[model samples]
Target chain A: MGGYGEVHYTNPTGPGTPPVASLARFVVYLAHSFDDRLALRSELEVEDAKVEGGAAGGEVSLEQAYLDYRLAERLTLRTGLVLPPIGIINETHEPPSFNGVERPGFDHDVIPTTWRELGVGVVGTVPGKVGLAYRVYLVNGIRAEGFSGDQGIRGGRQEGQDASFANPSFTGRLEWAQPGWKVGASFWYGGTADTNSAVGRGAFAAPVTLLSADARYERGPLALRGVVANVSVSDAQAINAAYGQSVGSRIAGGYLEAAYKLLQTLSAFARHERYDTQADVPVGVTRDRSLARRITTLGVTYKPTWNTAFKGDYQLVRNAAGAGEHQVLSLGVGYQF
Target chain B: MQQPAHPAAPPAKVAASIARLFGPGARVDTVSVDTTDVLRVSRADSLLGFAAVGNVLGKDQPITFLVAIDPADRLMDVDILVYREPYGGEVAYEPWRRQFRGKTAADSVRVGKEIRSISGATISVHAVTLGVKRLLAVLTAWHRSGAIR
Candidate 1:
């Protein structure tokens, strides 16, 4: 019937104070309309401490209830228990859409965004002079360590962990927009569940290939972007590929970003990332691999209304060959209806 | 995690737009839409324009609108004007831009092969279902070719 609640406090770093992150949640967002052509929505979430225990500790399921049928600016046809569309905020969560107070840290720990499952898919647009958009699906993949942004937002849109087997894996994405250059590429195959230990020595072998690419440029006010990724696995666990990271092993990563609004309220951001966790790391030693450093964000957002948002950022972490530099500071507030 | 895009608006002061749901004035006329291609609301209050297809405009970006109506019957009081990308209330909860209200012209034209697709506003419900079926087949062929009304 209704849902919205938030409370966070984590002032622990020293001085023996206490408050290392006490989180609470209550969600039940709804939007029903079976007549305009059927638009049923449901998001039931109640977690007093989800990532802490599991199975929705505070309790309540139905994170997303679906049924949409508008079918044509390009094409449409959705099926229930979904989410895994992957990337860009895992289905556009609306905090001014996105720009650092949150979102974009290797798309959330690496390839996870609005992640979801229980498939049935289609996206639109065609007849291109220069317009091609697509998002194809058939879900339920990813447990990477028991995720719960669904299958969509683990970071940016599927992949950072989870869904190796238990069959039902197939994800495809293709995008190309005109005027302000845009490019996208995605592919995935799910299935894994065989092991002798050491990460599970290729137990259910066959199925681990990932590739990603994105590029953008928007004239006027100024905008530019870039992204790259690659994943390959199932070597009978070469030793967990050599030691441990997850999903068959062998990995790659990339990032580059820029922004400037300067005023309208204010806008300024910066991002620089490098992750190799050994690159896909199963065993390591491509120079000993493991690189997860970052020089991210000096953000800003202060919207009075347009869906409300007030966020701030600063994080300069390191490791992955760079050594520990750890610097953190962040604040956030988001709303949508 | 790559973006430089920051231009919600700047170009078009007015080039071609007429998908009106009404606001500035009110009861005008000239309607016809069907999408895939064929748009021209002629003028009722003119505003409608959309595009956002999957994860709609949040996960990676794909948002555009010229606004006016289709706030999906919020008692119908639409008048947005402009917005390039990034949540205008998730494109005002686009359910294919609320299929452009009421329905007329001997009504009979669901959307995109009848209609069905919205998982997190896949491209803003396919640009409000192809801008309300291309402004209802160009305001029903400009009201059987009368032109204005």
Candidate 2:
């Protein structure tokens, strides 16, 4: 067993919000090898450090619990609660693995990261030097009733807690990796009705479709990576009408980051992101400009060891509405073992 | 799809790799010490290098690889012969392996220090690094003791 955690101090330059220091996340990872052909992997996570009875202070959840059955060198079958193969950060979000103290806003609003569901999937690499890999899974789908304008389908995630499978979804990713470069594309398609009569009860009712592409290139002291994604809700109007909501019919966003190593243990990076959760609304609903956001961040990370990082960053956050703009200064220390 | 858990590259494959690194007409002879067998490569009367085949645990399974060292004790190349895990195979990429070139046993050979770290492949990278370091140390000791000379 091993674990990782992060502590953060953030000072936001916005009214009514006070500077605070907190333990952002603490996670424990466990894995067991049953045999040469089978293994179990899991992670338990705590957010905000504490969870009191009845008060909204913190949360504890199982992030991943999966069994991997190796059928061949190029193929493996995975079952149980598994993360959907989406953008770069969703599967490899260890604090030391990313540049900023926080994940990119694009991942938060557009991808709804840490996204996982009860599912079964196949993952494998094609034999040869081209370094191609693929993953595909069928999992429980989101619930349309939980969709909202601000968070889009993020709230709809059932997180494998007695999740409804009336509307199943299929998600897949194809990646090509080689020396110094990696590129990937992913897709998630499924229905969200979840047996809700108002949204219909079919597997494809009120469907949610997401497509994304990401790339990374690292050579010597310079590294660069980026991701773009688009999400569409097929029956948004009907669902909104039935639920008295304003869920968007479309959402889109992307971010690009570049890092340059200044020393063996220090690096500087900058990132720019733009996302609109309510990019498009139903024919009769008005879109919320605040749901469209743009953020720019500049940061430096000092890694005294491979599994530890000290990070600090300044961020400029803005919205299309031209209101509620803010800047933040954040410092954090994170580690994995 | 089928892969051996503790695989050794076929003789022809190993020979081809030797020829590529030591040039054509190079001959190979195995020197067994304890349970380990080290390959000695030479072209005519001049010694080219030594190659070691080994496996290291990656996540859950063994990653079999070949590491070649020059007579001067610098790493010439690293080649992954078989990668059993579904993930972390990026450790076998040419660019990652290239980092080992010219590194001697005197170097740290630690991941995230003298050697760069790859995101999402940390475990495999660390395992391979330790494997290479262990092999280098063994080779250095053998040379110093004139056990294979």
Candidate 3:
């Protein structure tokens, strides 16, 4: 399980700009294997600190539930809800996996992680000095009506709840790993429009295409990682007109991070990220410059054991629109058993 | 966590592996394998080495691995027999596991230092390191007590 909280300051030197505290998350991750060929994995998460049948501040969600079956030495079959292999953090964002109090903003805003879809796929590895892995799957399409200017198509994620099947998306990822270096690339192609003829929301032709690449390197006590991602929407004009929102035609972002382990169980790290959800707006639609943002984080982590971690970090946030700059301090703890 | 019913490695395969290590003509026997799946390997009337199979949780599931130690109490090899996790299968790759060869209790076998960390398999890396450490501790005690020769 992992728990995180942060204090945010909307304005640095302005009166009445008191810092805001948020209980970002508390999560439980679980996995059970019945045999070598079959297993079940799941996660339950709570956000915003509290929940009263979901009427209060916090929300409870089933983050993932999947079944896996080994088909061969190098291949496995998976079904049910699965996190798509994309950015560095999407599939392995356990709190201890990173140094920051919060996940990288580039992953949250542009890649829109914690992203899962009900799907079926196969994953495999080629055994060698230069290791190779590949995964491919199909899932329900996104919903265009849910796209927005600020959140981009993040809200369009149906999360497999009675997801529409008018169009299915295909996603694939390939990775190469070595003793000290790892690199990967992924692609997603799908339609966001799930309009019904009777409801007549709009023409169902908003196609979402994404490409991503990431790499990580570690030697001795130092670790380095970077990720670059971009998404392009076909028929963006139609999507904007249908939804009455300024969803951009293109979204892109990336981040670079470095960390040094100073002790057996202690480390210091830093990361810099830049993201623009509205990097390219639909024709005739004004772009929201505030959606273009950059952030830097400095943090430290103490892990008494490999399964647990205590973390603290400070962040500096800036926007391209010249909006109010802000700073944040956060703390967190995480454990797995 | 429910332990997988599957053997860390197939019995026939494990036997073949031991034979190949000692010599194609040598006879092999499984002295005892407990609930933790630690196997006691024997050759003829003397202890040739010790072997064990165990599971360590990776990102989301258990990774089944095998460890073989020579009679001199040094690691002979480590193999990832089954990797059930969806990603980070690099831990099972042969080159990565080869790093464990020749390691002994005197060595730290730490993940970030002596053992190289895998990018996506950070957890598995730590898990394997710790598992090997514990296994070495047990094997060293047995050796010192003259339980194996």
Candidate 4:
């Protein structure tokens, strides 16, 4: 039932081969400004999508389609298919705008990048009257399945996981910058509800919860950043009899990273990440017996132009059951308008 | 970006100078400037503060001048320097900057109240304008009077 759903939305699995998700879309944008103090801008996108690989693109649906208003010099609000500010990469999700063909492997573990919902946001300069000029933003929460990784480890925030209605949630960031120096801090909090029938003859759900924070500093061509995040769910009322049985315990993870720019368009970076699910930890340090996952990455990013990048890297992965590692090569292309 | 002190300067003298102005915690470190790593002050901590305080300086172009009630007050003076900004720098040069001389701090703060905003760089103009106004107040009352020395 999970893989394949209602027949009305599901087109035949081809002439009987495999089903394909069809997400047709259209978009338009308009922008104008006067005296720079005031500006008008808008965007519209239409979506029609279906799962492609798993059950061969599960169903057809409308994904993201909205309009935005850059009302004042530093404030912008968007509704309709409202974009949710999830992680560092998602808000800045233009393909050509980042390092790898895709975002980092760790970012998705909590806040799925590019996950959008019907909501709104405000982005602009932080007051400006105080001291250093800083920028800040607040956005809505995204759909559950839309917030996590393939296995729901990163951002599996499925509570109130409505594809149609976005729940009340907020994400924000503040940054201070000078000629060659920059520093920033960001936070995220939200609520969700999860439903499943794994334990009962009838379907039921558990509550979805999340909290996270991060900080970073950049000087000249060098940068350093750290993040700590957690996903929580009180399965006490879980329909699944597995309760504390099959389910390990809780969920938490975080990482620290550093990078150096080799050129205006190229950078060398290394990151260390740790995570654990179905277990608990003290001070972000995992205490589970053998369910710990640690990933260390070393890579280089080449940007031939402002909006595009080429990346190559290797990750050293360690699990409590002894340690081993592998190299995965990635190629990706991205852009924004 | 803050200026790097000359390499020939004695390390102790450089440290003393920096501490005089920025206090003791400020330490120089290696950082990528453009594409090469060079030893200088930590860019992460100061750059943003610098950018916030940016409006005063011109880009790549440097101009140094002393400010005092009279030329005889050179020893008790305030030094104003401009660098690295193309569009807004025009406001800091000649015709516009000339308006700054001999005026009190209340003279041109908002720019809108006393002077017209620069055409191309609004934020830069405002920042620089405000910095100049504040610097004048600081120099005339404190630094020139030896409070900083």
Best candidate, lDDT: 2
Model 1 per-residue lDDT tens digits across residues A1-337: 3444433333323345554333344566765544333456666765554644544346546556667665643455666766654444455544454555546657655565435666667655454433456767776554333311111113212232343334456777776544334566777666433232433334233445556776655444445576666655544244334334333254556677776656544566576766443343333323342344455656666656534556676766655566545555666665554
DockQ of each: 0.05, 0.25, 0.58, 0.02
Q: What is the interface RMSD of candidate 2, in Å?
A: 6.4
Ordering by DockQ? 3, 2, 1, 4
Model 2 lDDT tens row, A240-335: 988888989999999999999999799999999999988888787898898889999999999998679999999999999988899999999999
**What are the lDDT scores of the predictions, listed in order?**
0.46, 0.86, 0.76, 0.42
Encode model 3's per-residue lDDT on A1-337: one tens digit a residue. Answer: 2232332222233456665556566677667777767888787777776788637577777778888888887778888888888888888776677777678888877888888888899888655535888889888777878887777778888777897877688888988888999899998888777863322344335678999999999998888999999999776777777667888889988999999999979999999999898889879689878889988889898889866778888888888987877787777776555
For model 1, the superposed segments whose C-alpha errors exceed 4 Å read A1-84, A89-109, A112-121, A124-135, A138-169, A172-188, A191-204, A209-262, A269-289, A299-317, A320-337, B1-75, B79-149
True contacts kept of 4: 0.00
Q: Would you list the clashing residue pairs of candidate 2?
A: none
Reference-based lDDT, residue A281, model 1: 37
What is the Cα-based lDDT of residue A77 in candidate 3?
87
Q: What docking class should model 4 receive?
A: incorrect
Residue runs of model 2 more than 4 Å from their true location after superposition: B1-49, B53-64, B70-76, B81-86, B98-119
Candidate 1 residue B20 C-alpha distance from true site, Å: 15
Number of the candidate with higher lDDT, 2 or 4: 2
Q: Mark the regions of model 3 whose C-alpha exceeds 4 Å error after superposition.
A: A1-17, A53-56, A127-130, A196-204, B1-8, B19-23, B32-50, B55-62
lDDT of 3 by residue, B1-149 (tens): 55644335667666665665565655444444234444455656766677766666566565666677887889987767666666567777777888888988888787777888887787778777777677776766676676543
lDDT score, residue A136, model 4? 29
